[model samples]
Target: MRIKDLFLLLLLFSSLLVNAQQKEIDSLENYYHYSQDAKRMEICLELSALYRNIDPSKGLEFAKEGITLARHFKDLKTEAAILNEMGVLYRKLGELDKAMLYHKDALVIFKSTNDIMGQAYCFSNIASVNIDMGYYEMALEYANRSLELKKKLGDENQIAYSLRIIASIYHESGRYSEALPYYNQAMDYYERLNNKTEKANVMLNKAIASSSLHDDFTPEIVDSLFSQAQIIYERVGSKYGVAAVHFHRADWEVRVENYTAAEQYYLKVLEITKEIDAKVLYLKALEKISEFYEIIGRNQTAYDYLSEYVRLQKELFSESKAKEVASIESRILLREQEQEIDVLEAQQKTRNVIIVMIFVLLIAIVLFLLFFNQRYKEIKRLNNKLNDEVTHRRKSEEKLKESEEQLKVLIEDKNRFLSIISHDLRSPFSGMYGLIYLMEEQYDELSDEKIKEIIDRLSKSSSQINELLEDLLSWANLSSGNIVFKPEIFNATKLINEVVDINTYRLQTKDISCRYDSSTQFIRADYFMVKTVFMNLLTNAIKFSDSNSQIEIEREIIDDRIVFSIIDHGIGMNEDALKKIQQPGKHVSKSGTMGEKGSGVGLLLVYDLLKKHGSQPEFSSSPGEGTTVKFSLPVK
Candidate 1:
């Protein structure tokens, strides 16, 4: 095609792109004005991100509006999300301090809400800004932390992004070889997800890393990679990618002493950077061009480009400082407006006083009687209002105190539960770790039978660990009100049989037998919670029972309530222990006949659940006399 024809086509494409973007903005604006409540807040956030690159000032304005609306609605999640968008916008505008401030603010919210993914993203953003400021150590710390979190979340795209960030950190620190592995890992993940834009981005960086590796890189291979990345970027219309590729190519040409080719590539980089409004890339391209000219002995040309680069750098710095000043001025204006309101109020009070004084003498005698009556009425009304306010405040304080006390109790229970879990967890984990270490060290000298024995021990430890974790999570969910309580009609016998089957190993280990008479009754209660209660009761019975003992589970309909009991023939507790078990927080547990561990956490959980069901456990036990625990639920 002719040059003029190509130019016309490009112009048409640019016009169409501009028109499309404007239409999107207009549609969103209409929706924003017409929307209400959270919808309007959401539109504001959307518009904020849409305008972030095209018009940063407008983006910041929309972001501020979003934050205000979210705060008014007490929507912390929306507020945190908007804060992150504002941070990114500020970063794009080159306000690094403001960017970091917003990110840290969002981080506080994310941490408070326990949003792991949100926290990870915040850390990654902080690291990006730190990298820009040349704080490599801080950047590395945040990036690594983000990578670890993303890994745990098992989000491949996020993990890839994190890996890419870490690679860039290494690359910036001149550890090209160290960066290569991470870049490759990120590329592989992106490829597997079929993320064209991100995959291309990783490819470009990987190429750059290879180029920087000097003797380890083959020029042909690096060039091929760069070509592939550039094609993908161009296909995707990524201006940043295009600019980056051009700059890298210019650098490579300069390194190989191809002055003419380097000049052409540098000029292309500058043009693309200017088109994209990327000040940093444009300045870098100018600096690189100047260096190339100086090396080629064109001193005058080099000086002119050098001066332009310095001028642009200073202009960018001045713009950032001006923005900071503008922000401070805005805050000052808000304070001034508040002060103006105070002055207006004072003037109104003065006017009222003057009017009262002028009218005081007109009806002196009549006014005296009228004033007394009005004053009395006013005092009566004020007294009543004051009393109501005092009562309301007292009530509010009482509720607050009650909530605080309840929260404290829950926290203490959680701590105790966690302590038991940690101890239980530590035993299995430490055993597995030690056993694995032993096998590894003695692999060559150990017999096959010994290795098998070690494997068996590892499996047992793993099973114990898994069971403990499951119980811990279930209890935590139950206590935190996260578990949904849905009552339904279900056969009690089936649930009991399932619970018994689950504990078959323990039953067999103790050479114990369980007997239960199946009932055809349906109960109206939370099936899961009821099942958990049964499981805990049976577990406790088995733990306390001796080898070859019998555990009897029975269900009886008494006065329209289904009563369930688990009777165990084993060593029983004394009066004090029984009393302690019935009381809250005083869970007195002892080792079983087989030296099995007992935390009593399970019993406490059962007690709370039973109370929730409008009943309590009836425990009867004495030394060597055995124990019987029973609870009741409403029948359907």
Candidate 2:
């Protein structure tokens, strides 16, 4: 049979398996109420997961019921687990605030109950959400906390998961050097656990990191890594994993300029996503394909794919919200029934006490009345005191939370400054020192040509160092709220040309050309800040480009704003670099295409300056293809 036919057969089998699982769930539901408390909670959790992808409403219903039962039994451990599940559900629905709230709440309960394992899981969940929010600092912090706790617990699978999260955070920050050890550690643990699924995931992650570190690993090793992951995923019948493997492979193919293989792999990803009914992955594949088409200059096809992606993404969000509403209503109704039962039980207990009192009333009615009056007053006094204590405790908790948040901000600032000192300042100065020392040693024997070359290199390094110092000062001034934004009307074309003129020498030195296509659009913004944005972007284009490659700078009026872009067909960046470049104070420098040097802090300054003018920068790149960085400013 053909590959397509085989896929259809496998899909049919998977559907049948799903149906059988549903039947088992139905059987469990029929006898659910008869089961013991512990068994019931287990069953509910199982049913929730089984239904999670099939019907989100049913999944949430089961999860909500499980949470309610866990709380009623005072099962804090189980409740924390269920809350984490609820957070995951909310995250899937794109309700980030609700997801964060639930995870934080779970963390608090876990800490209070001293459930170390639950606390680790809470940390992991928080880290994942923070990663999604692009809060790399917090993500790293939480991932490390989770890893530490898991280490103490000594569970291989849990430890592996924690390690993976930490690796992921490091990788996301473009710190692949820091990430590799964690990846290797996680791989070993997963192998010891014999967890094929997680092993496959780790392999894929390792390959992605390898892609970013061009000098550390060979292309063959990376390809082999991807292949191993693909085999494991396929063997385990993990459609999601298989799709992920394909996507990564596609990315690698693009990097190697194997356009045909990349296109085929991308299509395969879409096919697998569709077969597995994975909407999010399907959407992601569509977007990647759209970008691929754009790369190949098929604008119409790219737009068509993008349009479909946007439509499906919106639909998915709407569907998630609607299901959430239905599940919430179901949960509320179920809780009401539980509450009614509790009320009835309480009423019965009260009646029994009254009857017992009546039976003893004839013997000591007067004595009992005097004692009851005193007891009532005493109970009321204690209740008042308890309420006051609860209020005070709550206030203390709020203050503690505020303090924790402030501490996080402070730590982030310190780390940023430390990065500046450690890398930005040290790297250039260290190079200058070494070069000066070498020149002094070779002064008598060196030829004039060699001396002139060294001087030129030294000049270039000095310029880079000077640029870094200036950017650092600008950033410091901005952070201190001392840099004033003076908005004025300026021609976008004129400003771009000026920036190009300023960087003309850098471009000519590399035998590169700069071209601009801009209308006579005007924008009201801080002129110097805008100019700096263009300068940094243009310089970056020049830095990353190979000799003789052309840079395209364009400005267009889009929706009453001037959209400016600097395009370079040079050594492109990976996703990690893109993420790191966008993050404030977290940028890391890499050597340019022609051994050009940089301080890596320019983008950070540019980002802050753009935000100062109410604009957001955007980046798009694939390795070897090129990069496009753009932002829009309001028209005057």
Candidate 3:
């Protein structure tokens, strides 16, 4: 390749890497430095318009900060101005109650100050709040109020805000006929203002309503809406807007059952969301991905992403942490209230106490007797409760310790039994096999076919005995605490191959075809132990299935673990069988789908091996449809 060609190739590769990412750094920078004062709440308002697309959190943050400062400075005008932004934030946060509280607060202040425009905006907020809370009548009333006020103020541009809220109310209230006109009206107002972002938002909202309400939702309409949203987002340099558009597009993809397309859009959304620190959107995106993966039976992958999302949520909205912060703020407010109350109360108490002292001067003897009895009774009651609690805790601890000791002893005894079975049983089987072979040769009065048949029968019996011995030995080795698992980086693909090979004879006889799929990512696991698990499950699957049945072997990494699933379209058990499988040694042996007999030991060995190696044996099966067994080991 020429040098120019190499440079061009590098550029293409770099573009490919970042093609899905948002590049709105400049817009984000422009938004950060606006003022939030009375004369400049207009600047704050402008920033809200910009921030909704670029970084909504930062927008909310700035708007809320202005609300705090405005309230602190007692500037009703500025405080009232942030109501719209506050509603937007609360709606996105999914806390419709808090959103309602802020909107109503602004309304009360604006109404008291006789600010018609601010009050009108508050009506719009109220309408949106009512819509989310499922109060259609209340929502419609507020929406109409906002429209009337907007017309009176002759603010045609602001009328669009009221129209959008009304449209949402109508959509949610099941009045599609009413909603469509309002949506179009809102879009037209935006067009008049030359506001591309608002126009796109309106169009997108219409698409959502149409798709959600109609069973046969047309793809063309959704595509058109998303295309408009994407262009507007790009035009305004808004990563948050781009993320939102991608997220919606992903939802549409899922509606069409195009999981691959959905995944691509979800990934794009995550990239943009992460870049913009759009945590709320990021959380929602991760959850959507989890659902998609789960639908396709990628449980492990679903689990991993769900775990991360849950972790982030716990970090973000920890009730205990929020309460702690609230407590700190509340305490300051309480202390100030207390100081004021104390001052007033102290003076009143002083006057009342003087009169009480005069009146009590004659009743001191009676009061002393009453105070002494009350104090003694209260202290005794508290002491008794404390003693009872301590005694209860002591008994609970003792029982827990006893249970732990019993479990430890049971595990040790189980390991000892396994060792004995491996050693003692193998010795007798070896001796019996040797004696049978000698007899076969010495007693040659039988024909050649008879001798061959006897030898083969003995060999199959011996092999079954040997397999059992191996399982017990493996279990004992793991239980002995001497099976050091020095994890080496290995291809799960190759490990699965080797496991499938071990089951080849069984599979071929039954006409069961096993399928294996893997990714390039290497998983760190105890290779031998993991391989043993795969071998056991595969063997079980093939054994259970009839001739011409299919067995699928699935493997995937979910977060920090490697999961393997063996699924067979074979003779499956019901819920009762599932219960028996949990405690492996308890189930009776049954013939395979191909008339192959089992030691009933296969499941026992699998359970023991998994228990020893540290993976949970999980399965779900019916009477005849199929069986699936899954096990997962931690990835290093």
Candidate 4:
């Protein structure tokens, strides 16, 4: 094709891309107006991400709306997700500090909710912002953390993205050799995933790094890589990506001493950045073009470009500083609101106490009047039937004594239940609080290993607290007869696999393997209840099982019932423990082989759920032998 024809085609393609994106945005906006509650919030979040690269200001507007809706709906996960997206938008707009603040806030929410994948993405985003701010060490640290989490999640695409970020950090710090291997790894992953956009991105980065290693990659090889990346970027309609390719191409040309070609590439970069309204890229182009002019001895032209670059830089810095100040003011406002809420709560409590006192005083006065009237009646009756009144009083005293004894029993039971709950819940929370306090007071003084250790402990405590709350809620619902048993036919095998999958981290931690037959088996039971039962049992087995041990899950058909068994090789129960387990109301749990603690309500929940299914859990164990727990459900 002729050069003019190619240029016309590129312009046409860019127009079509913009039109398509605008149509999508219009459709979403229409739907958003009609949508209500959670769906509207979801659309808002989607729109925010959609507009991020194209129009950051619009993206921030949608993100803020999403955050408001998420908070209103008490959806912490979605709120954190929108906060992270806002951070990305801010980063794109060159507000690095504000971006970091948003990401850190999102990270805190993700951690509190135990959203591992959300936390991983936030780390990656924070790393990107740090890179832009020239904090390479901090960037590398967060990037590695993100990479570790992505690997744990087993998400190939996310892992590749993390790898790419880490590579960029190295490349920015001038460690070209270290960056190359990571870029290659990321490229390989993207190639396998068939993600053309990311693959092209990595190709561009690899080319830049390879340009520094002329001994390994020839100039021709580097040029080919850049050509490949440009083609892909154009095909994908990535305007910013295309601009990046042009900017880097200019750098490669300058490196090869091709001043004329380099100047053309730099001008092309300037045109693309302006067309896309990418301020960051535009600033970079202006700086580079000024340098290029100086290199060619065009002092007057260089001064003009240099002056423009300085002005633009100052404007961006001023905008970023303004955003930082706004963020600080917003935080101060939030703090003030919280303090006002605390004061209101205190006033409300005082009013409640005063109201209660007034109610008690009124009751006391009424009782006094009733007592005076009763005494007057008693005085009149005493003359007529003193013996009859004495006999009635004796019987009444005996009945009152009996009622008091019953009330005492009820109070003791209530106290015992409350004690059990408070002890289990408070222990974990106190440990978590102590760790947090230590970190808050001495974070700067702590070594990395010590911080990691504290984090691990905090995670465990949080997990323990979460488990306790879940079990408590389940037990409360079961005891109150609020949990309805809705039976349905479902694949029992699939349920077992899901339960196992959720406990993967635990299984990996203990180095325990689970063995179950892959067979299609349907059973009639409450799907959620049965899932809960399986989860609790499997978790118990994992906790008890020694490292490198295997837990076997088996299902066999016996008559009309499907018998499911979980057998674990670990410390078995003694006679006392067995007796305790047999008691339906008793919460029977012990420290596991690895000294893992539990709220002891899990087994009670399991037993209650099994009973609702018209089945009982049978246990077989010896003091030194491993335990086997089996239950049956109706096969449909």
Q: Which candidate wins on lDDT?
A: 4
Alpha carbon lDDT at 575, candidate 2: 91
Identify the superior model by TM-score, candidate 2 or candidate 4.
Answer: 2
Tens digits of lDDT, candidate 2, 507-529 = 89899999887557678999989
Count: clashes, candidate 1:
0
Most accurate candidate by TM-score? 1
**Model 3, span 68-154: residue lDDT tens:** 667777888877778767776667555588788878888888998999988888888788778767898898999999999998998
lDDT comparing candidate 2 with the true structure: 0.76
**TM-score for each candidate, following the candidate numbering:** 0.43, 0.42, 0.39, 0.40
Write down the TM-score for model 1.
Answer: 0.43
Ordered from best to worst lDDT, the candidate numbers read 4, 1, 2, 3
- Ranking 1 against 4 by TM-score, winner: 1
- Lowest-sum lDDT 10-residue window in model 3: 1-10
Model 1: lDDT to the true structure: 0.77
The segments of candidate 2 whose C-alpha lies over 4 angstroms from its true place after superposition are 1-24, 35-114, 214-217, 234-243, 267-294, 297-636
Error of 1 at 196 (Å): 49
Alpha-carbon deviation at 21 in model 1, angstroms: 24
Give a tens-digit lDDT track for model 4, residues 290-350.
8788788896887777667756765775575466444433333333444445647683332
Q: For every model in order, what is the number of clashing pairs?
A: 0, 0, 0, 0
Off by over 4 Å in 3: 1-119, 125-133, 174-177, 318-636
Per-model CA lDDT versus the true structure: 0.77, 0.76, 0.68, 0.79
